[model samples]
Target: MTKKILGVFVIAFFMAAFVLFAEDAPLAPSPDAKGDNFLLAADFRNAFAEYRKLLLENVNSPLSEYYFAKCVSVMGSSGGAINPEQLLDIEKINPKNAILAANLLRLKTGSFLKQGRVADAERVADEMGFVKDWLIIGPFDNATKAGYKKVFPPETEFHTDKTYEGKNGKNTWRQLSVRPPFGTIYFSNLFRADSYVAAYAAVFIRAEKEQPVAFRTCSSGPLKIWLNDRLIAGIEAYRECDFDQDCTAGRLKPGWNKLLVKICQKDGEWEAALRITAPDGGRVEGIVLQNNIDIIKKEILPAYIPDDSDTQIDADSGAVGYFSKLIENNPDDHFALAGLAFMYDFKKILDENDKTVSNNARKALEKNPGNDFYRYLAGTCDEDRNKRLEALLQLSGKNPPSAMALFKLSELYSSTGGGNSGRRRAVSANEAEDITKTFSVPMPFREEEFLNAALKQNPDFVQASLALVGIYNRRGTPWSLEAEKISKRLLTLAPENPVIVRLTYDDDLHTTAENAGHYAKLLAVDYTDGNARNYCIYYLKQAGRKDEVLKEYRAFLQLNPFASSIYQRMADYYEGCDEYEESIACLNKALETNPEDIAAFEELGNYYLILKDIPKAQENWEKALAVKPNLPDITEHLEALKPKEKKFWEGIAANPVVYAAEALADTEVPLHASAVNCLKNEIIKINPNGTSSTFSQQVVKVFDEKASMNINTYP
Candidate 1:
């Protein structure tokens, strides 16, 4: 009975196993189901939808929330706008996901800022604690009334309306507002200079009942302010954003106080605005309405004038013509003549053949010998033409009258060996140092002191200014402090002079606009001045202005039409700009100018190679080699082109039968035998040299003993 039970169990197990093996088994299909095939197929909509569904259905999945946020951030709002509530929901789902939250906030804040809804944007920023950290205000409305009411109240009364005179005079009456706490005020006007004028426009702040009010006003040009007819702050020269002169007078009384602003734009455009923030850090407002009308008429009206002279100075042709006319009218005007002479000198330096107007400057001076200006002009011409000693002799007379002439003489002397060997050697050792000391000593010395005597008589001398700055720079002093002081003075005198502009802006000591202005100041000058122009172009390129670089390079080439390497440089520039065909054309032009140019051949060959024209590459390489054969690198490259052969062994057996037959064959055979016999004998002769020899056996002794030493040596 037990045996019968065991048999029955075995039969049942086999039947169950058979059924299980026949049926299909269950497997995980989730990987394929959730795969990125939809993304690969570029069906972003479907992929996004599926991802969202997965996140909702599998909230516990670690990667679900992350991917869902990524998709939402990338897709953004397709229709009206993304609902803030939905975003808030995502944030709550994964609060630790900072990047996603930050991106979403940025987009929302950017949209708000663009619409000028600063209040709403600030509210959101407050919630995110980003109010103080991330904000860029300004390009604000700068009208005078806008600044006043924003800071004070309409009921506030002024002490005097008759501060100055005119239609929009300083005596004009207006209401002022109480001051706001803890905020900065930005004031501006349209005067040629930046000085303040009491007139139609001013700031009036309403004071709190007992709170002390403080403020600051910094100007780049000139500015002034008053509180209830009381002078508070004043500045002569403008310094934008400076903290020194731009401060409030003191605390103010509460209830109806007036503030007046007298601003001017002497040289350029002007406008002003104020930023008022309460001490409690709650209230913040910018540019409010006011009653001052003349501020707009006088200080601000000139800014709007269509015929303002300052604007004309910035216009390209106008600026060029302005200098040109100055030179034309006052042919012997030292400054004007010097300016014009330098302009032409620049061109001459760039292109020696361009004598144009510059060549006549010296003649103008000769026409007016009493005009001390001609001396510098003649000296400059001589110096530019490489007559250094002659220039020094003409300018450095015993009765030197101008600091510029003396400075030029000093430069020439220092540059041209300073007289004989001993003196020259001594000067060379401390030449830069001596020049600095001599130039920095200021003006007014004995007749024997050439530079000082000349400069003392002519303090406004441009040459003296240039000399002072140059000398200070070469002295190797710490931080170039002396040079900076002199340069600033020079800039104030001639703000638009190219040389002064370059010196002020190009120093290692200055890396910001506050330190100086943009390098554009340099470019604004004439490019005919070779040293200044080249330096300008170099700085522009360093500043990453590639378009300007190409333009300047083109101008340089125009000035130097016959310079040989310029064509190649232009070609390189074209190639950098991805103008391959232009590069090829330039190279062709270069070859036309100089057919024997090996560099052109090499460059052209490279161009063709890039185009994959191997035959053309070979052609140029061959041409280059033909001109200068045995050129080391080219010879090796040519040799590399030769065909190579596959190596093989000569005497190895090919088949086992051949080897076995050779082992059974005889030792000796005749010279001329039947073809079959020769084959057999040749195999047998292999053993005749040595039957007992293995492949590694010493064959030299066997050959000497049996192979016959008398056999012919030559094959």
Candidate 2:
């Protein structure tokens, strides 16, 4: 009994000590000692819960509130709800805790920016003194190891000297007048150049004091940087340039500072843009810079436009004048004819394009009658069955005929109730789209046998496998297992190639969320494919899992920031869910990505109209008109909402005679005039008072507007 009492006293003493320690201990900065690893791991819900608990324990603790706000920001990054009350509370508690307040504001600013609230974001950013302008230089030749050192010279004077040009093609500094959130610029814009042009950019900045500033830059190629004449940060290889891709903190001096960037380009695009701010990504007032020279040039060499000839093609007809001249000079100019044929085909001028295609095919056949490729081309271009059959016979008769020849032969055979090895089989709808040929009578040719023969010729032929997958998927036959296996193998063999994903999806391999997720994972392996990523998201959304859609798009945007269309998708998704506010925000963001996007403006106009903001809708449509005039629908919509038109509607109810006179004057939208006429006839028959006639006219107008609303369609 004495020993048990002593043991109880010992346990009570230990528990008392623990309680005292817990009471005295300060709150942890995050759930984990290091920080919120949950957020880093993308477990936002749990992280949010942990932060909530911390805030509850110490309600007024600024750090806890700041972290909690971050959790909110992360959760709401993809159009989730934001608690304005909580954010405003953080604003109220500022100056008492400067760091915490700044962080809270930055989070608020980001939220505003994401939602396309540029005015709100700029207001916050201005309060913070964010750097919005800089002077830039370069796109020099940095293709070699020796070229690299020349970009960032070892000499200190290299930065201080305005006249200094390095051993390679580095040039003097030039002024770049722009703000953050801009798209990648082409090197060809500044000066005429080939595909693989490299350059260096330098900026001279002045700050009021020595302080840490948030530094960010985007480049469409490999980039290296030196700030204050010292190496700061860099991305060593080619990447899609975007805001905050290589974002970091760097120190600015009390006076003059130099920032040098070396961007190495291989092809596609060549340019960079920079942004600087406070450590919290807020504005920094009094940051300034000036340069005498602006290297920007207005000329964009016509040769630089993708697939366009230096000589102008007929824009209206999509005809290549240069290729036409080349063929005119020499009737047997097969290459020139083929080029024109391809251009026409790309423009979808099929009738004209097909004639050129047939001409080229004929010329190629004349050049080499034994060439299976030429024979196949002739077969493909010709619509007549007899002529196509003649080309196919020639193609098949060649020694070691190509896989393409066999595939084409199979497609023709499958169109008209063909069997495996001439054994008759039933036609399926799944096979219809793949087979270009059609016939009333059954053709005794085995489509599968021809396909198998092609596979035997080249076992690793991707096209053959894709064709087979399509047939198997559509038919839902026992061959589906084989199709699945082949798809899996193709994905592995050509992991870097995007064709596998396209073929797999085309074959309906990603029918379920689980299977679609597999494809998303595959696409995630490479950073190049935004369309493939979107394709997977489409299937995932179709599977009734829309919650994951925003998350996936946010993740994709993080990697491919220049894919402005993804923002459009997010806006569409939000709009469909009846989240008009979020949709509006996304449309604003889309404008930031591509300011000239007419579709985004049109959509924004429609959203405002839905919200009953007629003036705002008109403003957006006017902006769209400024970008592209002669949009009949926009013109019609504007006519109805005009202040003059609105007055007529109100006056029609107030003074029927005056309103009817005004309505008859307007001629746009025949339907509107018809409705007005019908209303006038009713008003005349009744011989009602002015007010009653006006009321009746107004009623008809409402019905007419409602009818138009029912048929809502916008580009």
Candidate 3:
């Protein structure tokens, strides 16, 4: 009884936090604090009602608009389409409300995606720069409230497939790519079976150089955030999930920095929202989201980067075996079958002749005769879209209807079939109990009369094929495999169609680096087009094609030379290729475009360093440090270059952990070069066993004094 009352008091305190704004803050809380309280409590339904009143009271209130839009977003409903400008421009990220900046990004991106404006959606996603892609896993025990503080294995290190002690017997990390109408992770979806639990979400954001970045995070329960395994935020208080509720300044190192978030579930809602922005709260450009920590952790990725196919095979190995074993025990395991099929499909081994996928699906269908889901998987076994469509059509009279099947069937009809069935769209899963609940006419469709009429007469009907293509575009998700299956046919039919080219790019499993050719096709469709411009430049750069980079650089210049990160990247590329002069020219252009380009300043210093122009290199390094202070590498380089800086007194022997990424980064600056310039001898010592013993760094160093560090082994 005492604990429950204490919980209520804590929640009330969190709700009151909304009213505690800085003095002279322009915007205040709602006229009545009820809505604010409800919002802080994660009570979106009541919050929605309250915000509506607030909005009506002051339509011009950006605060009201923000809260109202946030309520709609949290509630998983599209109240109506409001202007993106209202979401972006009105809610400025400033002293009073720094977190609103990330909120603006999420809401803006979600708004564009919801409207089915894919090109606009893609642009917003790329440009707005807050991470929405995350791999989340959990339901670790929190029943006794200890879970909130418990350090799980994921906190120490994370593997996507590693199973740890979850609330259940077993749980592995699953990709929870949060998208539209979901600015926050609604953990209720992931941890449905378990309550009083905790979950962890992780993603890596890469920075070209050490730079300052601001972060805003909030959760419905106790929350802890770690950046590169350093605890940045830890809020033990369970509060309403509101963005910017806990805003803090953070720094990103010169590589991928892991951002791991843990949110505990105490009661009503389990949710988390986080965003990383520029220190000034604008979109932090040049930052990219990494889906995995392979390169960062330096565990799996070796000296050379593996092709995508090899990587996918490595990823699918665990799932394939786990699900295969489950199916052996219970052949009717729909989930196991689904998991197995997924792995097989990803592995590109799902063939009708492939023993496991086909035979297991066939056996499941034979036993549970005419089951919608089993039948669907059976059709999938054909491994052909046309045949799959035929199979879905045949499922019209299946014994037990599934809402998922019904949705797919409706989509199939929306493309190939005609639904005179007047089926109100299957909106909810419960409606599967009675298909008639959705359908005004008969449950089973007359395929000859109502379905595939276009394809029956002319199989190559372009419009029909295009409609089929539209069904796979998921909300907030950039890629969809279902769309990719039919992409080839559409591209062949209308190779020049801009939509087809763009959609194909979205679904293609191939990296943008491999699909750099899409740039020309998209540009040829409309040279004035800017949507594919960024991606095209990025693709060419990633592919390391110098000629293509120059070509795209020219094309991008024509589109918008002022907004050029392309040239800065090109500078990096040129330096890599030893084209120092060309890199110098690119850096100059980059500096011209973005005067505050710290990367350009840093790289120019690097180029000058190679050219042996000490004065020029030192000058540029100073400028770089001036732009973004507290960058240890540049500061170290500067300190080393300066005559008065710390000098090695000889006999400086030290041990350094050799990361796979560094040992193999560059042949020019190998281990000996570091040793020659040694603050310490970074020896790669091989033990008597003929292998180097792994040594983890135990010394601590903080470089607050002009980002300078002195690691004295004998200090």
What Cα-based lDDT does every candidate model obtain? 0.42, 0.54, 0.55
| Candidate of highest TM-score | 2
How many pairs collide in each candidate, listed in order?
A: 50, 16, 1
Name the TM-score of candidate 1. 0.31
Candidate 1 runs further than 4 Å off: 1-405, 416-449, 507-521, 524-564, 573-582, 625-715
Across 20-98, the per-residue lDDT of candidate 3 in tens digits comes to 6432344322243575344323234565676556544544332432344444443432112123444354444332333
Could you tell me the TM-score of candidate 3? 0.31
Deviating ranges (above 4 Å) for candidate 2: 1-395, 398-405, 408-447, 458-460, 472-516, 526-531, 539-564, 576-582, 592-597, 609-614, 626-715
Tens-digit lDDT string for candidate 1 (1-715): 9999999999999999988975544322322133233332223345456655665554443233334443453243121122333433554564333323433453455445434354554455443321121011111112442332232221133323334232221222332221211122222211111232212344434444534333334333444455555555554442233222232433344443445554433323343323222321123233233334454445433432111111111111111233467667876444444444544443221222344444555655554444333444566565263443343344444253334455555555445444433132223436444444544433222222444444565554444556666655765575378778777777765665656766776456655332222544443433344565556556665566677767766655444333336678878877777687788887776654344456777777667655546577667767767656677655543432332221121232322223223323533432222333323323322332233223212221122322332222212
Candidate structures ordered by lDDT, highest first: 3, 2, 1
**Runs of candidate 3 exceeding 4 Å displacement:** 1-126, 159-161, 174-183, 293-715
In terms of TM-score, which candidate is stronger, 1 or 2?
A: 2
**Candidate 2 positional error at 176, Å:** 12
What are the per-model C-alpha RMSD values against the true structure?
43.1, 27.3, 25.1
Candidate 2, RMSD to the unseen true structure: 27.3
